[model samples]
Target: AGTVNPLLLFDEIDKLAYDVHGDPAAAMLEVLDSAQNNSFTDHFLELPYDLSQCLLMTTANDADRIPGPLRDRMELIEVPSYLFDEKMEIARRHLLPRQMEKNGLKRTNLRVDDRCLMRLIEGYTREAGVRQLERVLGSVCRKAACEVVEGRQRVQLSLARITEWLGPVKYRQEPAAAEERIGAVTGLAWTPVGGETLEIEVSAMPGKGHLQLTGQLGDVMQESARAALTYVRAHAAALGVEPDCFDKIDVHIHVPEGAVPKDGPSAGIAMMTALASALSGVPVRAGLAMTGEITLRGHVLPIGGLREKLLAAVRAGITTVLLPGKNRDSLHDVPQQVLDALRITFVNEARDVLEHALAQSPVQDGGAVLPDGEAGHAAVCH
Candidate 1:
């Protein structure tokens, strides 16, 4: 059996232990190497074996925790979290039927409609996978079975019924309502579970020329805020912001939900919009959300998780999204319903982001407007 080719599975390989006993991951390297495993030897058997034909597969919750050399030896395939619609389909087609049989309930006796399932998903469960959803469905089926045993012939589940059974809603669909105001902008963020709308708020006060960043932001996000401020400062004259504004006042940028640590470059455009709005006293357009990185030269850089972000934007009732021009190619991955629900603008430069994000021109204060001919010049500089 040792010599026979067998499939091997290593679960939670990232948690493989290392100690004085020796490293399992280090030992696995030899066994996993196709070119070397043909004559692999086991210490216990004291015999040479052929394991070259053996298939190896591994799973991990976080790939970054895997040892670098071990990770480099295998092909990496990232499985993104399931979307809302996907979860609804899975529940109707698979989970409901399976739970009905397991709970000794007839399919005809217990019926769950799409609306009920959607309610369960939105209010009862918040997860990237369907394990919790399956459990919830099973709970519903068990309750239905009990009712049937008590002489209730049939049970139909709806949102109201789901709420009664589930006790209370576990999660809020949207964290906060979208408000139109100066110095506050909505941003799209991606998490391990799903996408969420993040609000970046900027406020200016009388103090030394310093930028204060809060909300447990990581270094990368802090740098993004600095870059955003610099861009706004460099184009202050064009944006109709007073040149000495930053020199005389301190700016504070904060992302809500301070308990959760956030680090990424995708909030660059949002930060820029917030800062510009705060300085120019112009409100950002209501229900507009955006995500992208920005360069010092005011070019918008592409970021990942576009699909999840867009879905989040739609869920938050955002009517418009501003994304990098380079990300236009990835729009095909987004559902057509989401595309149709939101007006998406692809922008190449920071000016374009401002043009769409701000409700009115920042240059409304009688500032010198760039000539039509200079539009091409600004684009060239970008």
Candidate 2:
């Protein structure tokens, strides 16, 4: 089969094995490099093959895991995860018909309405792509086919029947807090699969000033915790925290799901808020989630994965989100319905984040006074 120009897809290239056996990334680089691939040859056959004319495409779950040298040779284009509505349409338009044909069922043999499909998507599957959703659909088709063979002329899947066909719901999203909490804050995190809401909790106990971090955090996140604490200590007076209060207490910070490793600089502001709340007894408002990096001087810096993070916030039932002002422009990538669901506040500094995120000023009985014009939304920064 001598195809002039064939299309080749390399799936999950980032999962290439690394060991003494061979250098997979280096080999991929040679194949992907148009300049070097023209005279490429299969080692088994001593024949030169011109692969330069073939269009090649590669995909990966995590772009950062790709080798630097190999990544430099390819144009990187990020594909965002599908939303619920998109998945529903895709299943109705493509996956369901394909599975129906494969299961030897006529279009009229089984009827699964939109309600049942949505239930399957939300309850039975959780993923960045529709692959799992498609599999679930295929399973539904097979079940219907079995019924048809067992003397049933037609089958209709209702919302109630979906649960019976599939086992119990496999995934459940974390619910947002109903009321304000002390020393607890909601943070947004970006993972290789998708985004998730991270809850950070802090506790202060009487001791000789020691900071403890938990929840299987990685090195960068641990450093972020230190930066947040330093910011809190540096601005103790302004935050209504006694300047020497930290010296007499031991503080511990923890993220939930201790078994899962967590790392990133995006939680800097959330860590700082938790510490300030614990020290000042101020409660952060419920249904408020935030993500952005912070500096020692209390400036809010931009973070990546804005689209995924915002979607996760909405899924968690958060009503408001605090994002770095610099990321304001990145909101265009997010779906408008998601943007409209929440009140998004952009901040350039840590104080603005606190102003928007906290239920009230941290000042206890006016111990520390805030200047005017700092009480409301931060000005939109370019």
Please, what is the whole-model Cα lDDT of each candidate in the order they appear?
0.82, 0.85
Q: Residue by residue across 14-45, what tens digits does model 2's lDDT show?
A: 88889998887877887899998998876679
Model 1, poorest ten-residue lDDT window? 373-382
Clash totals for all models, in order?
A: 0, 0
RMSD of each: 5.7, 5.6
Q: Which ten residues in a row have the lowest lDDT in candidate 2?
A: 373-382
In the range 126-212, model 1's lDDT, one tens digit per residue, is: 777898999999889988888999999889987877877878888776633456787899999988677889989988877678889
What TM-score do all the candidates reach, one by one?
0.84, 0.90
> What lDDT does model 1 reach?
0.82
Top lDDT model: 2
